[model samples]
Target: MSEQALSRDRVIRTLPLTHWNQPHHDSGALASLEQGNVLFLPHLSFTLMPEELKLLDPALVAPKRKNITFDPQHNRVRGLARQQYAQQVTDLLSRYYQHCLQLIDALLPEYRHAVHSPSNTLRLHPVSTWRSKSSWRKDDSRLHVDAFPSRPIHGERILRIFNNINPHGENREWRVGEPFPVLAQRFMPHLSGYSPLSSWFQQRIGMTKSLRSRYDHMMLQLHDAMKADRKYQEQGPQVTLSLPPGSSWICFADQTPHAAMSGQFMLEQTFLLPVSAMLNPQNSPLAVLEKLMQQPLL
Candidate 1:
């Protein structure tokens, strides 16, 4: 028998801030997210501390879309300290990076088990965005899933936490499409076989940060195929959510088809969750691919 399809109501849910930090894990909610669902948290309010508000002023920060990352490793702040990237502005924005991390950890379960202990690597992406008109890969205008050639996930899920922290009452607009399984079934036939040698060559020549695995190739193929298809990019099933400033949302980006239409000044946090921890592992890309290919994928 064919498996049951996920519904719109079951996929997207809105809940209050109180539901976030409960003692026990919400298995239903967790299942929804693991299976390409999105949590529309309009009531999740993140009020910046007075100091944070002053330091992270949108007017003061640099307008470069490619330079939104605020991790200490990125050194955007150090550049600020050295009178580069407008020292006064970048310094102010850097101060709030830690606070963004703390907020996401408190709000999501991707990092914690039912016992309330940390379970996964919470890779907080201190990305404050500004919409760009660059090439399709660099641009956020097209509908696509999140995948990086260098960051081969090896079947792990890409969970994301986003905050529409737009100042001046602006909203961060997004067009989120349906679940991944539907799209995968439609496009799987078109993707070419993954090449291990080619991937190794790319890593050796510094084309990728690391050796691209089969999972990486599959994700990259899915991303490119979906974006390149004009019909899917334009007429695909989707819903618009104009998230206001102070609101937050969470989703498994790797399994969800999405497009950023407009609006900016947003904070994004990324977390990696294991397929084994999922409420329904069969629903993940790793399991789905294994079923489709009639072999283990990861």
Candidate 2:
């Protein structure tokens, strides 16, 4: 795309806050989410206590650790130094995770019962000073949808809440691309068919946490293809999003094509919502691809 065209597309790509302020069971908010539009909460924030504020320092981050991860399933926090403040960090993240859940329940009430707890993660990270010597697949700078190589979600929707806590009032830059169905149409023909033998063998050898379904296979391939394509990375249909300090946004990461450009002091929570619980299940990435391919994905 030309500079002028890209600049014109830079308009904020988010659902209005009025939708979020609607009733807890509002269908407008749910429909917006189901359509893969981000719900931008500019006034929403995770208030940090005095002690919790210390965790935002870039020095607290461990070497080679991209983010401080809190796994509720294991009740542990990783990627942070200063064991003395581990409990505080855990508490802060736990509270943030719960905050995200409350918002999700309020905005997307239908997903309350379908949210998977064990698969969720609360993460805090600094983007400004972090650097990784990684390949394209691991690079968040490249626009791509969410897909886990080790954990196959069996077509579950990946819902995520992100809060920018930058103390210096910097913006968390991100570029979001075209719709999920548009991306699938561009790359589906290039992806290989799923092999049952390979899926079973990988699960048996513990290479994967669970059996990889056809849906998972296609998603991983599409994820890689989007990142691998240089032309698409530079000229794809997308818009830039600048999330300011104290701003929080929620979206389906698996359905939204996104790339984190730059920022610092970010708190993120991931939640898995079952496809069956969606307000419009057919609008999900799984269903979109299944319809395009004319076959059952799982």
Candidate 3:
């Protein structure tokens, strides 16, 4: 493989999340993360690579669909848990985690205990796909933060780890469409047990109208402008990432907006891992691991 490809492969092996001790706030790569970008890390020499990517595949990592409560309203969905996938991805993640702990230890040695026993959970999103030659605009999925109002305040810090299994560049490019304004207008009020159309009277009409009318107006304009630009192309239905096999990304769920594109001959799978402050605990073997990461033995 070319050096560039080799470098990419090395990065896949050494995920920043699993390897680095703590984020180098002073480094350009780590600083970008404060602005909601990922800090990619190269794999450690001792880390083991999965013989087959399928071992860490979302379908295999998670359990078969089971009825479970999701959403703030306790809405139900059938799916697997993070621990289920952890078993499959554990060795791979352990390598990355070890490195991450070291960084964290160096920066916050006093709080190392908290980093060890972090309350971690995993939830997987159902994989959806579209084939090639499909219309991209009509299929445009809007961009929005992943947070829900119903989740606990701390839950807001949760990072949703997305793993893409499709071969690189096989699917069309996925784009993050323009953000929508008037959040209420974008969602049907009736779905929330409020109906602007069926008001007690016209007294509330002005308020509802003001909020709902502006929905997606700005985004629609931006979309049109983009299409008019000479750079517009009928892209496929997939977002391409140069992630190596067994590699994953830690993204601030509520901060980043993501979506897949539309196109033909596309196959993609996704898994969600929830990383929280509670992963490390006050007293646990994991805590010991967290402390070890902080101190470098000379």
Candidate 4:
């Protein structure tokens, strides 16, 4: 591994992020995230009030990987929640979704961040209440970037908004790993080249979702590389953070290497931001990898 690759300054040139502790969103917030920084904000506490919580299905707070997912197309949330309480959950989710949408528009004026309609999947992860298994998809103990094998993101970025809603005053613990460029530098050379023929075959057989693009392929390879390396997992440079209840955060999960160490009762909203929204589109992972390889990536 090259020492230059591991240098923090050489990896990510991030802008200073402003913390939104109140009910306010700044346009700079979008730029900050585009620059690969995380912003912490005050949560929308009114969404899940105490009474609303009582009505929620036990599966939501249950010690497991159960959570209601909102379909943007159908405009509804589906989970193990009871039919009687379904309307309540649906109403809450509708408001919550609108709040997030307003937030993005307020913070990203002039920035062309087109969030695909109905692509947002809300997850209620009760990490503390659940037992974590070693399955690659289930285990978030190890630091890694957000990459989906079935969901080919192409060159688009994964912008995630997370809220720690632990009603009992519990905080979620997370470990932020090294910069994306640093990780890529360390793992890129070891990754095999993307095979177009294989991708076509997989897409033909329904093995790959929508056809795994080269960018997605590389991202998956990098994710696997970081997770498979035991030495890096134990001794990598990182910072641990405890996100308290009533707090929210925004980040490009694809760029930020993070690990869910502990804690639970978290609500997450996923969004896709286009490369054109960046202050400098060339700084994106797709462009960065292209520059590094001296060729087009996707």
* Candidate achieving the largest TM-score: 2
The positional error of residue 38 in candidate 2, measured at the CA in angstroms, is 0.8
Give a tens-digit lDDT track for model 3, residues 51-163.
63444234432343311222211222223354444344444444334544455454324334543222222222222422232243432233333432211222213333333
Clashing pairs in 2: none
Those runs of model 4 whose alpha carbons end farther than 4 Å from true positions after fitting are: 1-28, 42-46, 55-66, 81-84, 118-125, 128-131
Give the candidates in order of TM-score, highest first: 2, 4, 1, 3
Better model by TM-score: candidate 1 vs candidate 4: 4
- By summed lDDT, the worst window of 10 consecutive residues in model 2 runs over 2-11
Error of 3 at 167 (Å): 8.3
Cα deviation of 163 in candidate 3 (Å)? 6.0
Best candidate, lDDT: 2
lDDT of 4 by residue, 130-149 (tens): 43545654467777888887
Q: TM-scores, in order shown?
A: 0.78, 0.90, 0.37, 0.83
- For residue 220, model 2's alpha carbon misses the true position, in angstroms, by 0.6
lDDT of 3: 0.32
lDDT of each model, Cα atoms only?
Answer: 0.63, 0.78, 0.32, 0.67
